[model samples]
Target chain A: MITRLSWVSLLVIMASFRFTVDPSFYPSARSATQAPKEGLAYVAGLYVGTGVNKPDFIATVDVDPGSPTYSKIISRLELPNTGDELHHFGWNACSSVLCPNGKPSLERRYLIVPGLRSSRIYVVDTKPDPRRPTLAKTIEADRVVGRAGYTRLHTVYCGPDAIYVSALGDAKGEGPGGIVVLDHYSLDVLGRWEVDRGDQYFAYDFWWNLPNEVMVTSEWGVPNTIEGGLKPEHLRDGYGNKLHFWDMRRRKHLSCITLGDDYRMALELRPFHDPTKLMGYANMVVSIRDLSSSIWLWFQEDGKWAAEKVLEIPAQPLESGLPEILKPFKAVPPLVTDIDLSLDDRFLYVSLWGIGEVRQYDVSDPFRPRLTGKVELGGIYHRMRHPSGAELTGGPQMLEVSRDGGRLYVTNSLYSSWDNQFYPEGIRGWMVKLDVGSGGGLSVDERFLVDFEDARAHQVRLQGGDASSDSYCFP
Target chain B: MIYEALSALIGVFAGVDPSRGWLYAAYYRTFRGDKWFSASLVVVVLSTTTTTLLTVAPALIALRTHFYTGFLLLAYGVNTLIHGALKAAYPRAHYSGPLKPKLTHLAIWSTINSTLSGYGLPLGALTLIQAGSQPYFYLAYVPVVTALATASLFRGVAHARSLTLNYDLILSALYVAVGAYSILYSLSTILR
Candidate 1:
């Protein structure tokens, strides 16, 4: 029989072993100083200003390795309003000819940024000077609500005929939110695109496999209900349960199926680039009630859409077991918040917010996803160590893939209020770059990290983008 | 009318969320409140019970001396003991027909019939207190209680006839359902 002293000795030896182990292994790759295929990537940076709803502005970060001030902020475009939460934005025109409804010009001329809370959309002219982007026009919230009867503008995407904007609530902020349509070139309010307002209320994200004539997933619940802090009751009551399907050309509702009673709050619908492959992936953000955060694969069979949970991102247990200080909040997984597909439709990248890690998966076979690589960063439980010897606070939340599928940039902030609840250490404003190998392996780029220690930065967009805007209708 | 009023009163006291209330209402409208479905379901249950007894009785008698038979009986005894313990821990308010005193005492003791009736009686009581007598509550409770009472009576008759087949089958089915219900109930409570 082992005594207490023997157990203590065993514990001590294990702890020492863990401390001495090398955290990450570096594989052979090209030099970090090699030039990217897209030339100089002028990244459109959306950051929260100095104070509460005060300093929210869009800046440009020169991400090109060959540039003199590479990985440094080049220009700042300040917004007039303080409270406009500048979140997700998309380009007006893409360089690909396969882009839906085909624009007259393929220049990445305009960048459409949506104010998540304020309901305003800013149209920025990036063509004037890609580095120094200037705000051309602002689509006021009141004007959109007046015409379209929807509020809380969430995601902006360039569809075939017009730009589609997913909003969270109605004019009075009550949900069953719908999508709003706008003229691609003129920025004209074309009105709401909801078919019949059957059950879909909370709209978060939507993507289409244009050739398959289908759009797979859409989010549920309102911003106010979901963003009002992380309460267990609020999570169960406020999150959504259904994944809707729509006809691509007709812009009409076809079918929808509930994912699961427990798997709620479906976000980030990442559809594969191969239009013939009628399959896409979505991740669900659940609270402690369901700590096993999962990624679901939705596919079409004989023309109807159905989804099944493919993989669960497991929560990492505390090394020394649960400490006295963390006993109250209960154990939770690294919330899988965002998902992005590579341009070539080979690799899938997922962001874990609660635990700081970006997981990469090879999803060539949509049903069976094989884990390729994972890079741990700052999170609620584990604070990531920066190269400068500083411990970053929050984990990765939003992910953006490079056009060539060689690089990935991630920022760590979900929402203003929810960010504070999870990462109580306060938002450490920073974004990191990961080098993606051709075989779906990942390595953190030691030389290319954008540090914004003062203000909270989020959602990175490339100068002449590739993936988000382009849609291949014919494989 | 009085029972309906009392059920409504208990539901109000239970204070379930509005979402659950909607679920309860929908379940009531579809299953319990629909006379044709309820009647058909009762017939199906009775026919299935008769078919199971006729088929399984002779086989059990033939295998009476088998080693598997002794193992099954041992497993059943352990299941009964655990079920009794659960019933004792979570005591419920039981009804003894109409115009009878409500039994508030926890079931610390166990009988062969009570154990064979499965853990459904105690589980139903707990669900009644937590979700009240809402149709959603009855959706699981009514069928379970009915199955238990019918199975217990049939088990007794089967034992008297010296053919333990029906008794064995009913007890096994009860064991599976009870185990599943216990796990799901615990999960729901903890998660909530």
Candidate 2:
């Protein structure tokens, strides 16, 4: 007769081989909102503007209020190479692991960090000890280019079966940027994701509604235009102003919506967290006509996709303290670099990088956004000091909301070259947390401020799952 | 005989890719224990074999010639190139929608593939006869073909039960390898 312990061991071994999905993988956005609060947040720390020659790193900060190391940098997993210019990174496996037909037995333990400028990818294993993540693998630039025929890697999203990465340009760093896929387990570059690219060329950000089988990809300029920093001529003639929709299941570009030539650089897409909802928000970074930024709602209409401008923030006219890039305009353009939707889809956070303000809008009714709260810190003219009397340099750029939508973490750096052009004084990278009110309000957490002395900070991801980190298959 | 065998192998791969292979495996898994479906599958296979032997074999034998052999090889190469190009251009041609729609597509595609590649076996036998080749030389392929087909079908069934194995990737690799091999061999035979 087999002992009870032996039987238990056998069952455990069998379970390991059963390919169980991660417990953190939520089935619906609503279910994710009820997940336990994340204790640590990962922020991309870059040493681009600083005189330091050290490589960019992913900083792990303790966010648990009860911990003695709360709001402290617990650890920093530095990349092996310098000039990586780490922009946005994500978990290797997300809620999508639970998706129907999605690969199983995969754990959400690796962070897929991509160097926007270097075009290199790092697989950081956040296992055994989440705080002390080690570099597991580094996929070189040539391999990525050879596999996907793309460069200037951007956003990373964990799909059902593969880790999807978006690139800003082709092999020569030219037009017609697209997505590259990697195997979930090995982290090996699979190939380009598009089957029929259609007329879409420029690519920056992408998000999808899985059950609806719809994926929306936004656009920014190619490497030639963006790497050298923004130019007025390029903004007029070169930057992308269209949003492409795709059949996610078929991997075919179905249609596109031109936000018009006036609205240039249509970047950053925040789809509804609910899988059943077919609508999402797309932010146009800058309008050449008025120097203002606008957000639009894209939804299915009459069996086709359509987008309508929902909210517009006018440029604040500044008489003095203008950067050279904006001196001719004589006004601060509300460059909405990034936006994040709460897990419950009740709130939308928009980051105005130019004028240095992060606004919280009640998007319960996405058609009409009501401005509920706003926080001003850093800008071209007014470099508003934090409540702690610490001087802040760059305005809010990347935003990450907690799983419960109770806290919002904001990072200041946009892009390395863009940072130097906009804030000529150089961006002293910093990250701050805002305590979101129970109803609709925002307040700076006076006790929580992460000061990266010289390194510039970009995207922030919560310990477990953030509002934008994961997508759902069920309503 | 070798060219015909290679052509048949290419046909086997072209009939299904990663996506199509997975779909067929899923279909089998869905109706595995159903007596009616199993019976229908066996009947379909038998009917297809009977029809090809009775009609396609004699016609190919009557039309056999050295010049015709070269033409056939070139024709197969060109056909493969066009089919591959079309697949590359419109990858979404494969069914990904509902199962009901996919079943119809699978039936149509299966019929077309069989009709086009059906000449491979007969052509190979006729080519051997024309060359006055020994019977045992061509008969050697019987066990090899049977084992390959059986092993691949079994693997597909196992993969369908557990999604962990990426049988699709294996299928895709097999398709590319067989397609490239068939194309290169056809070109060399025609050129020589």
Candidate 3:
């Protein structure tokens, strides 16, 4: 007969094993089963301040492997407003969670696009045609302001019931914005996330490690201040100092940890896809006072979330072979803005917007990330010559990794106004696809480049895709 | 006069009083040792409560008569149905109302839906229950209902004219400014 205490001990041990031995822990064979779909068809890129009207639009590029018109613009869906400032967008449902009980399989359906400044959200139906997605619905910021009382929408993430958007400010563009929830199907405003507004500053990005039941969010300044331009005083005033942790299911604030004054303005957060890993990585933008940038690793220890500096990206020196125009600055700031983890949870990709380089790191060991490979493209002052011998204007900002962990896509522009401030030469619309080798190496695919020379590009989304910041893994 | 008194009462009872205890608990759990949390709680609770009481309570108090009251309740019940039907019937009517060509179709629907169902119905019921005398209750309901109808009519007209009043803009801007400043000040190092 097993005693009660012995039974309890056995249950605890079993639970630990269940969380530890997830599919992410095991390296499976690289085959079609690992891919979101059999073949990659199209890649949708967000173009802001592009075109005659300067209205932001979604441009779809056909990337079918055997297609005659591969790597060419197939469709364009433009927004009504001219200065909506299209930024980060997401999908209603992706190839994340598997359906249970004979339910339909999860596929890429509606694309949720939010205007960072205008506060408008457009829902595009990708099912009608993957290459030519139609505008299904639009949610104006005024309605969000009237209902959810938030504005300046930043990031959009599809949860189980609703599409969650992180707003920068209140309806009138105030500070410490909260998460606005919208119905997944109807695109109606459900309400704001039930987070008690207690010193929770501006919300920038959010990601979850579901198995650990923990969700983390980073912050930036209010929309009004940020839109005007990132002043040195904003950093001095401690705009993005703390990272908030919450109960993933309940959406309740759990705890917050400060990343110190030097690492203020924490931006993109990529939680490890393996729910059991309980680890995520976030990078801080360059502060005016300090040009250096660093990546902070957040993980669960003793049932609590703790963060530590994992890698420090030092500013490039004058002798670092940068363009002569960029050498005048004290140092070449890495400006590590965006980060994405591969579906297999084996590699981490960091986008250095300031210096124009995408560094690939091996994160099999979550605590210590080893830099495996890096590819330089464009920077603030130094322009990289594309394979076509044409000088590329902007740096790598937004990054998306393919489901099978074989292809990586990157866009150059961050925001129209910010692009002008940093890379004054301006963004000549462009996106590059990098082939990811099994050994964690990266090489550019010369033939697979999307060039919208007249349009400025922001974010990229693929059909039946999975991204580090967007997708969820089933237990 | 009644709107002001009732708004204040609800603001205190529904928002401040109940929120204090809940906020204290939240502060203890998530914001202990952070002074910004306490200060922000006070401002947010006070301002949001006041705004909610002002915008929603009057609309509810207006639905005094059985017809208006019944109509409002029915409208709330069938809102989802109406929304789905309208969306299906006129898919191209992107946005139409006083708010647009500035607002989208979904925005108008969200605003009207939230105003009537989330705010108006519940607050209207509260106003009716709180209005003790039958005659006084009916009197209170008349203006509230009239305001709602007038506002709805004006919404269409305003959209047609494409004219936005400075007063409304000022009020919204002021509310946002106060709320934003309060929240930002709370987060600033001075409060910390």
lDDT per residue (tens digit) for residues B15-108 in model 2 = 2222333334334444343443344334333333333344334324544433345455444434444444343333323322322224444445
lDDT per residue as tens, model 1, A1-475? 2234433543443343221101111000111112145533433334443345454777688787878888777878888887676778886644222221232223347788878878888888876577787889999998889888888888777664567888888876778788888876577677888766565667888877653557665775776685465566666767786788886556677778777777778888888776547788888876344476888888887766889998887766654323333346456476898889886777889998877889999987888889998988887666676655666667888888876788898887787767766665578677788899877788888877777766677788865564454554333
User: What number of clashing residue pairs does each candidate have, in the order they appear?
Assistant: 7, 0, 6
Models ranked on lDDT: 2, 3, 1
Tens-place lDDT per residue, model 2, A1-475, is 2234433543443343322346677767787888898899888999865668999999999999889999889999989999988999999988875554354345689999999989999999888899988999999999999999999999999987688999999878797999999987678999999999999989999988876667899999899888888889888878898999998867899999998669999888999987657899999999999999999999988998889999999999997888898989989999998999999999999999999899999998889999999999787756888999998998988999999999999989998888888898888888899999999899999988898888999999888879988987655
Which CAPRI level is candidate 1?
A: incorrect
Clashing pairs in 2: none
Q: What's the chain B TM-score of candidate 1?
A: 0.25
Better of 1 and 2 by DockQ: 2
Each prediction's whole-model lDDT (CA) = 0.58, 0.73, 0.59
For candidate 1, give the lDDT: 0.58
Interface DockQ of each model: 0.00, 0.02, 0.01
Candidate 3 C-alpha lDDT tens digits along A218-315: 88777777786555566666467678998755668888887766766789888777554678888887655557888888877897778998888877
